[model samples]
Target chain A: MDQPRVGLFVTCLVDLFRPVIGFSAVALLERAGCQVEVPTDQTCCGQPAYNAGDLKNSRSIAQSVIRAFEDFDYIVAPSGSCAGMLRAHYPDLFKDDPEWSPRANHLAQRTHELISFLVDIRGMASVENVGFEAQATYHDSCSGLRELGVKAQPRRLLATVEGLDLNELPGAETCCGFGGTFCIKYPDISNRMVADKTADITATGADLLLAGDLGCLMNMAGKLKREGSTTQARHVAEVLAGMTEGPAIGEPEKAPGT
Target chain B: MKPQSHLFKENAKKALNDANLARALNNMKAGFQDKRRATIAKLPEFQDLRDQARDLKNHTLENLDFYLSRFEDRVTEKGGHVHWARTPAEAREAVLEICRSVDAKTVTKGKSMVTEEIGLNDFLIESGLTPIETDLGEYIIQLRHELPSHIIAPAIHLNKEDVAETFRENHTQLDPNRRLDQVQDFTDEARAILRQKFQSADVGITGANFLIAETGSTVIVTNEGNGDLTQVLPKVHIVVASIEKTIPTLEDSATILRVLARSATGQEYSTYTTFSTGPRRPGDLDGPEQFHVVILDNGRSALLGTEAQDTLRCIRCGACMNHCPVYGSVGGHAYGWVVPGPIGAALDPGLIGLEEAHDLPNASTFCGKCAEVCPMKIPLPKIMHHWRVKEHEAKLSPPRFRQGLAMWAWFARRPRLYRLGANAAIGMLGRLGAKRGRFAKLPLAGGWTAHRDLPAPSRGTFQQQWARHKRSQAPSSS
Candidate 1:
């Protein structure tokens, strides 16, 4: 059979803040024996609008997303938050529309989060030749864990990477408080949540912090860096795809001598 | 009591600065979350029970009128009176009329959120009657003249010292310097004070966990047996419940009760699950002489058949708040309403108005944790979003937030425009913070920068690099 076609939905945060995650997603998809395509017509999964209670704009944006990636065998996103929007919420966005409802439902059926697709759909149990010799902890982003059921898939794959010690962070399933616009809307509450999360991440004493979504990664990484901690945060895909040669998120390029 | 939900942001800020609240919230997180996890893990049939509970609520809600009428008929046949109240004023008046009929001066109350919703104690006070709270948590908050910050744990925002202080202030006749450090000390003092109110009160007002339509009974679950004393010892027992609390049968109530305590306080079953069929019967000696159930609609009936209809299934288990990270951080008072947390964010707008409670809905991170822990599967975040949609359509959202969202949505619809904007923003930000890799303070991002640094863009946008990478590989691959 021909290789399954996968459309990579690079979330907005990953596209701007960290492109390596996008690259890592392509590499992982290719390794899983799927033909990956990046549809430039896609901008976002319309979560901001939908979450902000602006359904008019949310529906309009969701239509463009459906049109861009409808023909692919599966539409995959590196972030569970965005993938959840595509797979679980898009149909609800157009539920009342006779014209767009079926189209939205069609796209929802094909969308999958990156790691879950690799592990569950492609049956890729382990990485071929990747190793990260460091103590690491993984945060289960709320949407990915509760919405798309992307819990064990990332862990199962991470276990196969050579020399990687996965320490389970206490309250690992809690939100990192970078809830799209939530961090900005209610900064006081959001700050307390992220502060608590960073303390837990630091308590693990793991040198590396990993999560599937770049938004959560950026939030945790930013908090960790601001607190003057040495724990580096990166996308789970970066480690799985052997793309750790680059500096971790929020890290400057290494000096020539060092 | 008057619905200060409009001040949620201010309340949240105050709650954040409170060290005592922080200590109490931390303890709650460690205590409630671990207990619920362990309790649910022990029950293999917990998930199946949740499904059944959810479906049963859905059926009852779909036929709410039928079940409510059946409940009224059964109560009347059993010599109990049923009072329908469409507004808070009407509900308050009905309770006052019943009290007047009994010539009651003192009223003892079991833990009831609906009474809190109607602001009953204050109303009773205004009408020249004394109302005492029997539940330990409720009595403690009552002594402090404060609203319940939590549903089941009314005084959860207060630490032991705070309770000790409150008991000292209100129980002035008792020894002020007595030992009150231990948990049992507080309970003992509260029990001693409340036992007199329970026996002397002429009317007892209690909230029903479930109002059975088939058996014409009202069920109350309490750990301290306060509800039983509050209902049985008084001459007149008044069961005040919202319209959505009606259940079709006793078995349905049992199924939901199984999850209620386990989800709320992590108990297998509350210490006392008392069911009162009606007022004192022919052979009854201890129960109340007159029984009255006040069913308040307030604004709940309007919620039926709407997107928020699922919220009616809420059993007031407080599980959603216990597991909620926002509630964990800020505690319940930050919500500035009778009900707080995820369920409050979803249901308060319907109870109160959307405009007044606007901040409650948007304050969430949309974490989905509340719904995950909710036994009835209310889809809390989704309903909160529904309130948001209404707020947006009504133009009730802040002008700046609305404009920002509108601008972003406009650009997002045009992919090419969005990419160009993203490219320019990323390019500039990437160059600006190339040295340190993040921004400690940035313009227009003060909210995020105030708490944590903002990570700078690594490089050009992904689409730009992906285009270049494909161009670089095209010559070799083809």
Candidate 2:
């Protein structure tokens, strides 16, 4: 029936920085027997602008995103914050537009963070295992856990991954202080908070640090490298997709042109 | 106690950006936060303590009517009095009545956020009483005629040089050339000035950090011991505090204290956590003749059983602000309220109306640092999101963002058209900016282009590349 389609929103950061999360999401979705379709016009969830007090531009981008993804039966996003923004923030963003408010609610009701959608909606909580192992700690993305309540979704999905050992990090719910523009605007204070967060990661003695959002991943990774620590960082989708085939953590963060 | 945050920021900016002020703020940060961290690290049950503390606050807020009644009964049983203030005006009126009855000309005050909450100092000054702030930081700001930038560290944004200037300006005889370099020097000077006020003042006022339902005791925690002097040295002791500060028992107060000082200054406990049950008992040499507890509701009771109810859990530790990036930069004054940071985001809506402070919740990166470090572990970002939702429901956000959501809701419900439209748009943007691979200018992207470059998407978007891969993987296609 129409190939039982699904739409994957690989947010801007994922598409630009780590393409494999997109691939991993596709692999995992396909294995679940749903034909995954990524709608490309998704420049961003408009989170950067939305967060930076740029409502008009964020609305324009949100409009573009909504127009692009309108037809999907189920819209799945790999990043919880982006998905949460769409489900949680967007409807609020459009409340006054008499026509858009109800419509935004419609999509907000249907949208899901990847793992939660897989387990809760698609019953992929006990999905077929992909064998790959690494000792790692999970960083709970703020918008995802606090905004969307996906704390259990990723854990259940990760539990299905073969050979992975999980350790708890101190202050697990704490922010890595990758406050988007905050990092650039107040880099000194941002670095202090990130250093504290990375120290907690190291104390876990886990070989890797995994999280749902790339904004946080980049922050933690930059601090890990700057402090010259060895623990690597990757997205939760990348780990579940087994896409860690790259230079180790301290490697020159793949220069953009290359 | 501080005034509303709006005036605080304007004054603090003048202080913080002044090169000398920056040198002072930078030097002081390490000592306060580092010592705080060392204190918190030694406490093994910090997180658990926060949970218990948060639960205590929730319990108190839920049964506020009961606790207030019990506290009133106990306060009266001790030959003291209890007065209820539904609003800040009523609170000011009750305090004024006591002052007028006693023919008080001068009032000595410890750092009390509740007094700040009700604008009591200005009201008393207007009524012709010279209110003296006894805490060194509060005294310095009082001399400057400014508001507290922070809850605990009222003068955190101010440095030693600024304090010396304030002293030089206010205390005409103080030697400006005396090299008042150390904070200790400034503290000692302020101490000497306030010691005189404590002796001469007829009435003392302070804010209670917690009001225990079991003992009907009002608790105040401070490092300077000024709160104790304010209560004990005067003939009359007045306590102005919010209803939410009441907990069922001292044990509960103890639980919250674990997270309070740690989340605030990273201290396991402040030097002083004093509790005053009532006036001095018979045979006590150092105590007040009369005691009064003014329970101010303002806007707290309305918060109970609402989506924003979780904010009632805040112990006002100031951790959320200390660790908040937005707060660290713009500081508390920009929030335009007494409470700032994640707590302020929730509170501003209730106090100022959701419309005026709509941007506060949206101001966060949702980085979750505040929630993490919070002693009470309030789900700050979640409450902020709840505010965002309320902003929408209340039509507080600008019209454009809502319309965008409505349109997105429509397209997000479809699939084939979604893919086709997405691909076409990506392809168009890619081709339009192909040579540059980055758009230097886009009329609609004024907000985005202002800050950072919006890089060009690859010609073959993730979807296009993925489609080819899926086809290649299909056995029939291969």
Candidate 3:
């Protein structure tokens, strides 16, 4: 079997807020025997516009993504929401446009979320034990768990990691409430939801929280930090790729004297 | 019963801060969710039944006019009346007229969202008739002068303590010092009070879970048996239901019924599944003397060809709300209308105008749990998204939100410019919060920073790193 050509859709959040997750994803994909390419023409999965009901711009942006990554044998993203947008919703966006609908469907059919791509597509049974030890729990981002069926794949890979203790978070399937623009639009409700989520995460007594989506990770990390919780948060890819060397997401940068 | 949906945010804020309500909501969260999961796990054909249910509703809705006329003919043949109401006011008026004709002094009521939707209780009271709620949950909330926060569990927003408080105030005839500590005591007291109302009332009003056109039967499922008593004990039985409630056959209703209770209270079947075809027959032992169904369109017919058509397929199982994280957090009243939660977010905009119910749809996280749990396979999130689209197109959303989206869209379309701008923004954020990986506050992001710190970006964007990596890998190319 020849190496599959993979284009990484480093989602807007990963590209802007946490670039390490993207690099971690590349490392994981390469280890799984894929030649990875980060398309320069890629900007976003256009979810912000699509979710905000700006269909025109969502379509245009999706078109650019489609054009950029169409040639790759597979397209994978580190975030479920963005991957879901590309895999599940892109075709729906162009359902009425005769010219673009087939193209959109073609792109959508080839797209996969990172963990699922590694486990399901590559037939990679277990991640190498990175000796990264932590009591960690995984948050199933809504899009990944429900839309893309990404529940067991991440857990399957995590099982192989040597020193990681995986404690299940209560109400793990519930939304962390980042919900893209929902966090900004209805901050109070979003806050209440994330507060509930952090409480659940804390109750698990896990020192670290990991999730596939950067948006949810960022939201949970932000809430945990505000609540002065000691629990650290990071992308699951970072741990699996053995790249948890830097400060965890939302951890403070150390001053020169310190 | 007034459409307070526009005040959803205020209501939600109050709901979140209410400790008693939060406790009540938390209790409901586990029971409903766990029960549904257990029941679903037991039934292997549940998914197939859901698909069958969805298809049945879709078929009935597509030929709704035909099914409705067929239902009317069947009901009329069975010596019953079907009153068509174009609006809530008309439905209320029709119910009032029926009560007036009966010279009814009091009406015993079963739980009916449609009646609450039309403000039937207030209308009946103003028309000089007393309407008594017989369902225990309904009775509790009615005594407290509060609308039901939940469809199936009407008093889910109230704790047992709230009920005890309400009972002490409203049931003045009962001994104040008597033991009212247990849940059973509340039920026994409600039954004792409602038993009298049932015997004396001239009319009974109930909501139909499903209206079968084939048998001219209106079905109501209840655990308390209030719906059965409400219909059978009165001279006149009136059922208020939306037009979308009609199904083609009894078999179809049976198929839907399988999923309904499992999705609702997680019972394989409610304790009582009463089917009333019409007024008492000549040979009948016990039943009402008159049967009238107030079939309401209430803007539902207009939704037929639109993106919202799937909403009409809803079985009112409350599964969507039960599984919703937002509804679980704030409880149902925060939605501020007769209908609440995910189903309400999608359906209410059509029933009430979108402008009034605009905030309802936006309240969701698009978690897809509502649709995942929905018995009818209704695409609730997709319907909500449609409402959002409608709100955006009509310029009903805030001007600032629209402008922000527009500006972002403008930058998002040009990748080169987006990369350049995003790279600069990342660098600025990284330096600003270098000492702390998160910001306690930031300009133009108070919504985010109010309750949580915003995580600062890394030193550079992914594109920059990719560019650097490519240059390093191919030394000769640079």
In order, what DockQ does each candidate have? Answer: 0.66, 0.13, 0.62
Where does model 1 exceed 4 Å of error? Answer: A255-258, B474-478
For each candidate, give the TM-score of chain B: 0.97, 0.91, 0.98
Give me the TM-scores for chain A across all models, comma-separated: 0.97, 0.91, 0.97
In candidate 3, position B332 carries an lDDT of 89
B206-280 in candidate 2: lDDT tens per residue?
Answer: 998888888889999999999999999999999999888888887888787767777677666799999898888
Candidate 1 chain A, poorest ten consecutive residues by summed lDDT: A249-258
lDDT of 1 by residue, A153-213 (tens): 9999999999999999999999989899899899888889999999999999999999999
Top candidate, metric lDDT: 1
- Regarding TM-score, does 2 or 3 come out ahead? 3
Model 2, stretches more than 4 Å misplaced? A1-20, A24-77, A80-258, B1-37, B432-441, B474-478
Better of 1 and 2 by lDDT: 1
Candidate 3: residue B358 Cα off by (Å) = 1.0
Candidate 3: residue pairs that collide: A252-B437
- Root-mean-square deviation of Cα positions for candidate 1 versus the true structure, in angstroms: 1.9
lDDT string for model 2 (A60-163, tens) is 77777777777888788888888988998789789899987877888788888887777777777654546556788998877787777878878787777788
Alpha-carbon TM-score of each model against the true structure: 0.98, 0.74, 0.98
Arrange candidates, best DockQ first: 1, 3, 2
